[model samples]
Target: MKKWKIILLLAGVAVVALQITNPARTNPPVLHDLAATNPPPAEITALLRAACYDCHSHETKWPWYARIAPSSWLVVSDVNEGREHFNFSEWPTDPELVVKRLDRINEVLDYKEMPPKKYTLLHPEARLTEAQRKFIMDWADAAGKKTEATAPPK
Candidate 1:
């Protein structure tokens, strides 16, 4: 029984290690028309670059810890999902896409989701303070308004 249990535990560990080692997101992220419209303000961009850009942008700045297993899998999964939802790296050039991005950003902020719990756990810096959250929320709102693409033309 003891041997059997040991073997099972080892097998599980192996599987977990394998899953972690196999990165889930590897594509080089891109930024589109970001400079033309919705160019991140220097301060906000710095904040985001330090905090949210890793998983949420095409320009993911990999840390040494990323190479480690377990964490690597989690990180890869997050980057993959983040990109799927809203990739700051791939800012949209089209007005419609820009509107969509703003909507999505608003959704993430209002829901108090995004920069998922797992991400914040490993990446303490990414944790949003009330002030920072408010700043980002305001940024989203203003950008959305500037885009002036809200509401369908009846």
Candidate 2:
């Protein structure tokens, strides 16, 4: 029992020490928000904001856990990776890129691969229902087609 107490104390100290290594959490200014640019319907906008924006936009709402050590590391890393892949706050201007982005969104939704399980496990509110998923997928398909039609010949 005494040995176990010592091990637990050491583990606690290590966890506290690890706090010094926590990544910086930042929400950069939104220069070109997707809504301002492409302008999805209000409902779709709301769905995206609720289900996808935390990690995929500069408007991340850092939760309480994000301030801790190991969890902070995972949260920050996920947000960074998500923004790198699809930053709604930094919407692309080129029509081709816009179309590509929309298509990618649709593909991910079709595969039920987004609002990743790990994220939804913690943020239950981010979970999308079947109807919500269909709505976003349909919007993405239409938006992609529209953007493709307007894109300049390459």
Candidate 3:
């Protein structure tokens, strides 16, 4: 066989092998839905659902591309990491945890870091306008203040 044919054959085999190692993507039962537990206004809920929930919550709506090999690995990894940082499905009841979460949310929003660029590229609905960003910032401010008020003095 030609050298190019050999290379193509190896690439095909590698792709097949990669499929076997694809990570499982699951939407486990939500212990505490954010909306049900601490309902935000409808607009905020909609924005969060569109932009953040795919990775940060138990309700991830896995796309068809997520079922593919290498892409599957990346999508699963991101969701796992996002949940590690903050999971609305498992909202913290403790005031301190709530404040920490709120602070993290504010930091990410202020830095324009959440709803990563790659995500917004494909899912335009996830793109936040300046107005939406301001709204989220306002909500985070209020939530953080409330949590701080309930927290014991350091």
On residues 1-154, what C-alpha lDDT tens digit does candidate 2 reach at each position? 6999999999999999999989999999998998775899999999999899999999999998899998999999999999998999999989888888988888888899998998899888899999999999899888888888887788
TM-score list, all predictions: 0.73, 0.91, 0.87
Report the error of model 2 at residue 79, Å.
Answer: 0.6
lDDT ranking, best first: 2, 3, 1
Query: Residue 26 deviation, candidate 2, in Å?
Result: 1.1
Clashing pairs in 2: none
Every candidate's lDDT: 0.74, 0.92, 0.88
Off by over 4 Å in 1: 1-21, 24-33, 149-154
Q: What's the distance in Å from true for residue 117, model 1?
A: 1.6
Highest TM-score, which number?
2
Clashes (backbone N, CA, C under 3 Å), per candidate, total 3, 0, 0
lDDT tens string, model 1, 63-87? Answer: 7656667667666777788778777
Candidate 3 lDDT by residue in tens digits, 41-75: 89999999999999999999999878889899889
Alpha-carbon shift of residue 17 in model 2 (angstroms): 0.8
